[model samples]
Target: MPDVKFKHVVSCSSEDPKNPAANLVAQEAFRKWKGVAGQPSVSVILQLEKSTKVRALDIGNEFSAFIEVLVGKSTDTEDAYH
Candidate 1:
């Protein structure tokens, strides 16, 4: 597996500002889950230092009725995500 570097959080649909989406990239396994509730759906946007093909993703203890993953090229504009 290639070294994966998490750059930053571009956006999130709903999150407890206190907890923050950035917690998802915590280096330690002791980090708590980034919680978002009272919403029908939630989304998170993350930036990577380099473009890479995501073969797999590991989500911690969180519940979602549905999950969707969309990959875009590094050169893609903001509109490309929507």
Candidate 2:
């Protein structure tokens, strides 16, 4: 049997620059991803970026905060989708 595994990493950062709600939104977005997969072996990394003038956060600064969701699937799953 093929040991199929799926993983996804998601990151969120606010575009408002000063809006604290962006951090909250990122957290909620990460939490929401928990339901994306029902398999026990599936793994995910949720990252948040809160930038300050003194200490810059890795999260990017652009117009309209965005949540990036990347989905990874194992080759073993190729048969399942078909």
Candidate 3:
């Protein structure tokens, strides 16, 4: 498996500062879920220390009604997701 880690929140459409983006990377099932009041479409960007080829992802849908995954290389300057 790729050694993935949360780098930073590049941008968020909406967020509750108290419940931050870091919560998405918690090890334990902590009460840390990033929230947006009215916005249904939100975006979060995560970075990897080194290059990686992601095959699959496991995201808990406890809070989000729907979710989408996008992958890109570190060198890309724009949000050109694959």
Candidate 4:
């Protein structure tokens, strides 16, 4: 099996651009999600216009996340039999 790839996108904002607490808040939030296994290509989107509260949007629906997993070999498996 090929190495699987995953993408995690998080959206958050800061009340004050100069406030040092903002970084801590975001960092903690990211840490929580990072603990999950098989998670690669993590990304974060910051919206300075919005409040400090973190908001997440599920890629598919209310019960699901936007994370995508792709697994497959780069080479052709069909030739294995030959």
Evaluated with TM-score, which candidate comes out highest?
A: 1
Model 1 lDDT at residue 28: 57
Model 2 — which ten-residue stretch has the worst lDDT?
A: 31-40
Better structure of 2 and 3 per lDDT:
3
Structure candidate 4, residue pairs in collision: none
C-alpha lDDT values of all predictions = 0.70, 0.31, 0.68, 0.32
Which candidate, 1 or 2, has the higher TM-score?
A: 1
Estimate, for each residue in 14-59, the C-alpha lDDT of model 2 and write its tens digit: 2233443323335234322222223323223432233212232234
TM-score of every prediction relative to native: 0.74, 0.19, 0.68, 0.19
Off by over 4 Å in 3: 25-31, 63-65
Which residue runs does candidate 4 get wrong by more than 4 Å?
Answer: 1-35, 50-82
Please provide, for model 4 over 2-60, each residue's C-alpha lDDT reduced to its tens digit, 9 standing for 90 to 100.
22222222242222334332342353333222322344334334223222332443332
Q: Please, what are the lDDT tens digits per residue for candidate 3 over residues 1-82?
A: 7446665556666557987777666655663556576767767776766676667776666456778888887788788898
Compared with the true structure, the alpha-carbon lDDT of candidate 2 equals 0.31
User: Residue 1 CA error for candidate 2 (Å)?
Assistant: 47
Q: Write the per-residue lDDT of candidate 1 for residues 9-48, one digit (tens) a residue.
A: 7787777776778776666555444556777877777788
Worst 10 residues of 4 by lDDT: 1-10
